[model samples]
Every structure is written in C-alpha cells, then in structure tokens.
Target chain A: MQRNSKLSEMAEVKLLGVLPSPYVYRVIWALKLKGIPYEFVKENLSNKSPLLLKCNPVHKKIPVLVHGEKSVCESMIIVEYINEVWPQNPLLPNDLHERAVTRFWSKFADDKGSSVLKIFRTREDEMEQVKKEILEMLQAIEDHGLGDKKFFGGDQIGIADIAFGSVIHWLTVMEEGILGAKLLEAHKFPRLYSWLKNFQQAPVIKENLPDFEEAVAFYKGLREASLGRAASK
Target chain B: MQRNSKLSEMAEVKLLGVLPSPYVYRVIWALKLKGIPYEFVKENLSNKSPLLLKCNPVHKKIPVLVHGEKSVCESMIIVEYINEVWPQNPLLPNDLHERAVTRFWSKFADDKGSSVLKIFRTREDEMEQVKKEILEMLQAIEDHGLGDKKFFGGDQIGIADIAFGSVIHWLTVMEEGILGAKLLEAHKFPRLYSWLKNFQQAPVIKENLPDFEEAVAFYKGLREASLGRAASK
Candidate 1:
C-alpha cells in the first residue's frame, strides 16, 4: 500500500500548456534539463481547461506546473522551481556573484525579450519601431550579456540561456520565415548571433524546439488575424 | 592581520540609491532585516553619478548594491542575493514548494504591483484608468494573495512583503498625502489592510520608512512638473 502511494506521488508532475509558446517552452526545457519525468497536458487556449484556471487562478495562463497538490505559475518561476526541486544539471551557478549575474540576465530576458514578439503581431507601419527595439535589445545582449562565453553563464546552457532561447528562436521565425527581414545582422550583433546558434544547437533545446515550418505557419496566421482585426477597427 | 582583513571585507557592503524610492527601500529593508550593515550612497537623478553609471551600465538605475568587487542590480534580485548570502532572518521558506510559491508572489509584485505608482505620476485625464488598474491589482491580492496569514509566508515577513512594501507605502502617500483619496479602504481590502498595518509595524520596515511629509512634497513637485509639461505640449 505504501509503495503504491509513493509511486502515485512520484508520477504526479504535470505541465499545463500549449505548444509553439515560448513561455511554455522555457518550462519544458528546464524540466528536460533536469530529467524529471512528467506528463504533458495540452491546453486549448481559446477555451482554457478548468484545471489550468484552477492551477493558475491569478494569471489564468499556460506553463503551469502541477506538482502533487501545488501548482507553480509563470515561466521563469516554474523554471527556477524545477531547478530547485531537481538539483541535477543545475540551471544557476554555485558562486554567489555568478548566481546574481545569472538572475540579472534572466530578469532582463523576462522584461525585454518578449517585446520582440510585437513585430510578429504588429502592422508593417509599426515594424520599423519594433525592429529598432529588438536591435537595441540584441545589442545590449551582445555588448554586455554574452561577451565571448558560449552561453550566458559559460560553456553550459543555464537559466539565462533558456530564458532567451524562445526569444531568439521566435525572432528567427518572425524575421526570416514570415517578414523576410534581416534585423539580426551577424555583423551588427556577432556575439548574439553566435549565442543563438550555440543555444539552438544545445542538446535538450535542439530536440525540443517547435518545428520550424509549424511555428512559421502558426505565427503567420496570428499576424494575419491581428492585422485583419486592426484593419476592420 | 587576518582579523583586520576579515573586518574590512565584512564592511565592504554599499548601497547606491535616492531617498523615498520604493525600489531602493526594498533593498534597504531586506538588508536591515538580515542585520547586514552597509553604506548608503545617494545619487542625483538630474546628474547621474559616475559610480551609479559604472555599477549598473545596463539600466543606469539606482538601488545597486556593491559588495566587495561585485555589484548586483535590480531591487528584488538584490534582495534575493541578500537572502541567499545571509540566511539568518530567512527571507525565503526552506521547503521547495513554499519557496516556489513565495517566488511566484515576488514576481507578481515586480510585474504588476508597480502599476499602482502610475496613479501618482499620470495626468488627470488618465487618473481614472490608472486607479481602476490599481484597484484590480489590490483586489487580486485581497481575493487570492493574503487570506488570514500575518504575512505572505505566514507570521514572518518574507520577499513578497518587501516586494509590495514600496508599492503600498507609496500608494498610501499618493492617495492620502497628495490626492486626499481613500483607495485602500479597510472594508475593500480587509486582509491587505491588516497586512499593511502589521507590515508597517514590523521592526526593520517601521524604522526605515521615509518621512511621510517629505515623500509627499517630492512626489507632488514631480507630478506638477509632469502635468506642466503635458499641458504645454
């Protein structure tokens, strides 16, 4: 009886999410890195499941990790929670200063990285402004964040790397696949360009990334819908 | 020689900030709670200091904590760094799940709680909209955040309390001191009202709160200047 109970407890980890979402992908990569086995429950965003609503009552958003009776919300918070629960393949550094620096970059990614997606959803008239904003963000990362290090922390892809993986990956889809723009010029942001290459090629990240064609189609639809709604308005 | 070296190393903590700034106070309260001693370096917002610019080149913002040769930016991140370094007061819970929950609230406070400040700085035309946003934020806290607990972590004041400390305090300043309004009526937010009373009465925070009249005058002048510029435009 005790053994059965223990098994049930061990198997209770579940993730509530929709695929092709950068926020959800952050949690997925963190869990994969930790090698903690879990179930993935797909959520229909248009009609949110009762479980998702119950799990994340405040935000009512995806990437909610349900562990046993408790549910953790927010992508970066879930990533940190996973790192805390499973110590293997550590996402943050051991040194105090290095950990602080890692967190600073993580916070930066959470704050500014999402703005890049505006280009995917905004009109062509606003594309230049959004592109300029994304370029400045990439330049900051190039100049101050990822100097010569293969990843933000060092050789290993850690929290900061996962935080940015979704941004750069989706930016590629939006800029190259849909918009056919060249905002992330290698010459302008050589370090960022290299960092994205290394990040995408990282083992867990490479395998788990959304299919390129699928992601392009998904965001292209979203852009059309957004522009269509705006035109009518 | 070893004793002298240790003492000097211990005394190397320093804080860069401006007075009455909630972000800066969050770090101050955290450090005070941990009983960590540090020097406070005031920065002129009009003329940014070299040390402030040097310490936080990315944001060029205040509430930068300089420890030995390392500097940590962002208020809540600095607070977390302080908690990690000094585990005496225990800003975060020991349980992995509880810590995750605490972090969730901390992130929420960082993300949404700051919107309350918009009421203080916004023009009259936008006042109602900002007020509505703040009321919704407070309602979320009332409904989901604080129940009957003395604090977010129960009994002890933790990271989330410090995160919202500046927002609530400044809201009180803006509403009561300047606007002569009563947004945070006790009946509307019974738990939050009790929490604020308990929070303000807490040891480290009570002693460190900025003088009420001074904060009022400072923010009022800034608001007038903001409105003046908007009118001219």
Candidate 2:
C-alpha cells in the first residue's frame, strides 16, 4: 500500500475483504482506478473479525470500506462512494442521462450477475436452467447494454464496466478453468464477449485481477470440502 | 396527472405503470415531490403493451419513466434519475457520507422489503418462515436504519425514505387489511412504526398514496384468482 504522507491522517482507507470475492474485487478495481492508497485487511469468512462485525453489523459481509471515521458496506455502494470522494478518474459519465443509463446497467449487473456463480454449486439437473438464465442475462447486455461502444460507459471504463468485470472474470474462471463450459460464446453473445475481453485488458483491472488458476483452485477446494463434509455427515 | 404547458414540449414525462404497484408509487412520489408533471399511462401487466416491451425489453417490468426520447426503467433508478434531472426538492443529502448511507438503506429496501408481500402468496406451512424473514428485515431497519430521525435521510424525507415508504406502506396494508398479523408491533419496532407514520403523512405522499382499502381488495382479488388457477390445475 502506498501512503500519502501529506494526507495520510485524514482519509485512511482500509478494505476488509477476502481475496477471491468477486464483490471485493469490484471495490479494489475502483480504488486502484482512482489511484487511492489503502490498506488491504484480509478477512476470514469462517471466522469474521471483531472490526468487521462492529462496522457492518447488519449484513456482516465483506468488502467493508472504512475511511477515517465512517465505514461503508456493500461493494458497488463503496465504489460509488470512492468515485464521489476522489473525482479524479470519473467512474460515471458527465451527462446526467448517461449517468442514469450507467446506473441502470450497474444495477442490472448487481441483480443478475450472481447467477453465473451458481454454476459452481449447481447439481446436474439444475445446471441447464442456471445456464439458460445466465445466457439470457448475457443476451440482455449484448442487445441493449453495450452498443458498439468500447465500454459500458463508452470510451472510458466506468462504474458499469467495473460492476460487470467481476462477474465476467469469475464467469471466465468457471468456464475455462473449472467447468470448461462455453456459455459466453462469441457467436451467441458477440458484443458481451468482446466487452469481456476489453474489460479484462483495461489497465488497472489487468494488473490487479486475481490469478485465474488460483481462483479456480480456490473454488474447487471449496466445492470438494463441502462435498466431503456432506459425505461425512 | 398535472401538465406544465411550458415545459411539456421539452421534457414530456410519461409514467408507464399500474396504480396498485408499490414500486410504481415510489417513482410517482418522487415525481410529485419535485412537482414534475407526467402523463400516467396505465399498463395491464397480464398483457404487456408493445410500448413497454420496446422501452424496457430486458426486464419488461413497470414504473418506466419516458422523458421525451429517453426512457428510464426500474422504480428506484427512475426516482434517482428524477432527482438528478429535476434538482428542485433534493432527494439526496449534500454530504457524501450521508448520501452513501442513504443509498445503502435504499438498496437494503430493494433487496429485503419484498418478503412481506410473500405473506400474501405464502402457504400455511411456509407462512412462519416468510413472516420470520420479514420480521428480521424490519428489526434490522429498526435497529440500524432509523436512529430516532424523522426520516432516514435526516429531517427531510429523501431517497432512502421514499425507497422504504413503499415497503412500509404495503406491509401495513397487508397487516391491517389482510393478514391481521401483529408483525410491526409498536412495542417491538417503535422507531420503524413512527417512521411509517411520518412517511405516510408527508405532504405529497399523503395526497398521492393509493387508497389502503383499494390496495387490499386488489391484492386479495389477485390472491384468490391465483389460488383458483392453482386449484383447477
């Protein structure tokens, strides 16, 4: 973590998160995009810390961004806060209509993107339904969300792009590294497929994204451990 | 529906919604608060119109705010857009932290507030679980969301207040008119109960709110019709 000696005392940012969390990575990408320096506090999900419990009593969830005196929970909310606090690299567009559109897609991603993660835990009978749902989500993005633009906010990577990046990255991890599925085929969802490539290669995101193989291993270990417990019981 | 002859040509706001929808009311309250005139276009959700399909192809859900050439979908997003477009009665606070906190609760309402409605559709075996979920949601808000403030956004009723207003109102209608359940007991959740009164009696909200008896009838009719279909099937 880089410390700004001049302004370190005022806005000391600390992120409480587990490394493999797609939600946590959303905040990390936003903070890195704005060139903000923060301490990365690793949290154990199985044994949550007192600080995490104290700060986010309601949800007791990860990716709690504590800035100076106040703490903000929830990933996208934290991203929006970081954007507002440090308006250097604007996460949202300038035009008000564009901003509203940006928020629409961001909200869409938050609402629907998590279903792709269910692929990891799904039984054989339910995989098809989950896959169909995810494909429909991709179709929505391909048809209406991205319109021949470089990013969701266009030209510059914005909030919506970051919001989808985590989902796409994990989707890729599950597809290529674990399940070897072809849900996000270029032929079917060309625009979304291209958008994923663009999002992955974006400067800050490219550098900071967790290793694909590592995420695959992490998820695989989790599945096996859960299965082992089930067998033992 | 009020029309501003002067600004009608430029903005031309049209709300596509059903009157009984709690989500639709959220957008209506925000628009009325800002004193923005809009044409209310009633939608029969049973047979969705081509206009609704064209405007919101993705979700095809209601509370679509069509402003001239642009259309914004999703209720809370529409509310936020209204606040941004017409900055008259500000929906969000000036302070950044307060704004983020407000968004947090608003998201919480969007995520959790719907469980109370599940009571209407819930079977006898599932009623206890659904009731428990709603109670937990109410307790969270009572404990952390409202801290003796007149509104969630402070003295003024803002975005968070509007976000919760719909949920709280629907919960009351179900409890008082339909279920007769003692879920929101004043002794249990005193702050939230008072906040509901404050929210319901607020200037624009008081006048614009749908009739409680009518809403009860609508929901009851809906439940009976669905049950009839289930029984026949």
Candidate 3:
C-alpha cells in the first residue's frame, strides 16, 4: 500500500485476480491498453487471501486493482477507473451521447455478457434451452451491438469491446473446451464472429490476452469441479 | 426529439418512464437535484411506446433519459449520464477511489438491491428461503453501506444514495404495501432505517418523490396482477 507521498505521485497499480477469468482479463486488457504497468497477484479462490478480503470486504470477489493506496473492485468499474486515471488511449468515446451508449452496452455486457454463468450451470435436459438463450444474446449483439462497424463504437476499440472481450473472446475458449460447442458459429453471427477476430488482433488486446491452450485446460478443470460440487450436493 | 442544435441546447432532458417505478424515481431525483429542467412522458409498461422501444432497443425498458437527441437507458446509467452531461450538483464523488467505491455500491444496488424481484416471484414453499436471502442482502448493506454519515457518500447526497433509493426507500413502500411485510423494522436495521429517513427528507428528493398513498395503491395492484399472472401460467 503506497501512501500518497510525493515519491508515490506516480500511480502504483497492483491487480489481485485469478487467471482464465473474463472479469479478470477485462481489467488486464484495460491496463495494457492504457500502458499502465502493474503487478498481478493470482489468487487461490478456494482458500482466499486476507488481502483480497480486506480489499473487497463486500463481495470479496477478485479483479481488485490497488492504485496507490486505494482498491478498485469490479472489472468494468476497474476499467473505467483506469481510463479516467490514465486518459492516454481513451477506452470510452469522446461524445457525451456516445459515452452514454458505451455505458449502455457496458451494462449490457454485465447483465447479458455474464451469460457464461448460465451456460456453465445448464441442465443436461435443458441444453437446447440454454443454447437458445445464449444464441439470442449473441444474435442481439451481432445484429444491434456491432452493426457493420469495425468495433462496437466504430473505428476504435472502446468500453463495449472491453466489456464483451471476456464473454466473447475468453468465454469462447471455455465454450469450445468445456461444452464442446461453438458459441459464435461464424454463419450464425458473421458480425460478432468478425468482431471477435478484429478485437483479438488489436495491438494491445492481442498482446495482453491469456494463452489459448492454457485457458482451455483451465476451463475444462473448472467445469468438472463445478459439476462435481453440484452432483455431490 | 431535440437534436444537438444550439436552439434546443438548454439540456433538453426528457425522461420516458412509468410511475410507481423506483427506477424512474432514481432518474427523477437526480434531475431535480441538479436543477435541470426536463419533460416527463409517462409510458405503459405492458404496452411500451415506440419511442421507449427505439431508445432502449436492447432492454426496451425505462427510465430512459433522452438528452439532446441521444437516449441513455438503465436507471443508474441514466443518472451517471446526467452527472456527466450536467456537472452542476455533482452526484458522484471527487476522488478516483471514492468514485469506484460509489460505482461498487451502485452495482450492488443493481445486483443485490433488485433482490425484491426474486422475492416477489418466490413460491409458498420457498417463502422462507427468499425472505432469508432478502434479509441477508439488507444486513450486508446495513452492516457496511452506512456509517455516521448523513448519506451514502457523506453528508451530501451521492450516486450510491440515488442507487439504493429504489431498493431501500421506495422498495420499502412496496414491501409493506404489496407483501404485507415490514423489511425496515427500525430495530432490525437501524442504519438503513435512519438512512432512508435522511434520504427521503433531502430537498430535491422530498419534493420529487411520487405521492406516497398513490404509490402504495399502485404497487398493491401491480403485485396482485403479477401473482395472478404467475398463477394462471
């Protein structure tokens, strides 16, 4: 914890999170985009840490970014905080209306972008139902969210893209490995499918995203453990 | 629709919302406090207006604030948009960390504060479970969300207070009227109960909050209709 001293004028960022987490990855990409250097502490979610608990007492969830002496929790909030603190490569748009639209999609990302949780908990008999829900969510974003723009906000990658990166880019890894299904079937959602490629190919995003094979292996283990817990209970 | 023209540049704030909606009230209170004048177009929730659908195509719900031709959806997002567009009576905090903390509470208000939705839909068999969940949600806020401050941010009103207004103050109205249950029993949640009093008495809040008896009657009707629909289905 670097107290606000003259020497500590420079923001010292320390990110507390677990890997293969889209929420965690969102923060990672935001930091990398702004080119803010930080130390990343991978946590053991099962055991938890005192620092993690102390940083986020309410939820005690991860992706807590400690800047100077303060901790910013929640991934999108952290990203926004990072953007405000370092406004170099502006993650959000310039126009007030565009900024509001970016927020609308950002909230959508949290509300609907968190579809992976529902997908993970899908019942064996209700697989089709869950798939339908996921597809509808994807389709809505594909049709309205992306349009024919290169990114969600057109030309540049902004908040909405960062918001969906975890759900689309990272969770796609989970969908393929754990569920053995393709979430963004290119034919079904050409825009979203194309958007994912462009998002991954972005200079900062391409560099910051986690390793592909590692993510697949990690998600497979996570799904098995999650299912095993449900079965036991 | 006031396009972004100099002729209509007096912050043309038009709120599209339905009454007896705490979500709508959140935006109303924000606008009033900022002393921003605006027009209100009441909409029928069941039969939403084309303007409502067009503005919030994704959610298709209100309170949507159409500010200078651009529309902002999601109540808290609308409030934040208001804050950014009109920085008169600042709703959010100054410090970056405090802003993040304020956002965390706002998200908590959305994530946990909206537990009333689940409580309203609970079955007779799951009544106790739902009640316990609501209690736990309330207890977390009571224990942590408030201190010796006059409001959630401090002595002055902040975004968190506006965020929780829907859950604590307004939802309490619904809880007693619709559920025949008293959630904010003074003895059970002293902090929350006290906070609600201060929140309601704020100049902008007191004057702007919907008529009390009318809200009660409206909610009672809504709950009956909602439950009736659930039963028929």
Docking class of 2: medium
Give the lowest summed-lDDT range of ten residues in model 1 chain B: B2-11
Candidate with the larger DockQ of 1 and 2: 1
In the order shown, the candidates' Cα RMSDs to the true structure are 2.9, 3.9, 2.3
Task: Please provide, for model 3 over B1-233, each residue's C-alpha lDDT reduced to its tens digit, 9 standing for 90 to 100.
Answer: 33645323375679998886889988988888888888999998879999999988887888998876677888988888788877988988787777888888889898887767555556667777767777887898888778777787888888899988877766677676766778778999899889889988988888888888888777767667777998999
Q: Give DockQ for candidates 1 onward, in order.
A: 0.63, 0.60, 0.64
Candidate 2, superposed: residue stretches over 4 Å from native: A1-10, A230-233, B1-10
Kept native contacts, as fractions per model, are: 0.82, 0.78, 0.78
User: Which residue pairs collide in model 2, if any?
Assistant: none
- In angstroms, give how far residue B90 of model 2 lies from its true place: 0.9
* Candidate No. with top DockQ: 3
* Candidate 1 lDDT by residue in tens digits, A109-135: 989987877876777787788887788
In model 3, the clashing pairs are none
Q: Return the lDDT, model 1, position A157.
A: 86
Q: Among the candidates, what TM-score does chain A have in each?
A: 0.94, 0.93, 0.93
How does candidate 3 score on lDDT? 0.82
Ten contiguous residues minimizing lDDT sum, candidate 1 chain A: A1-10
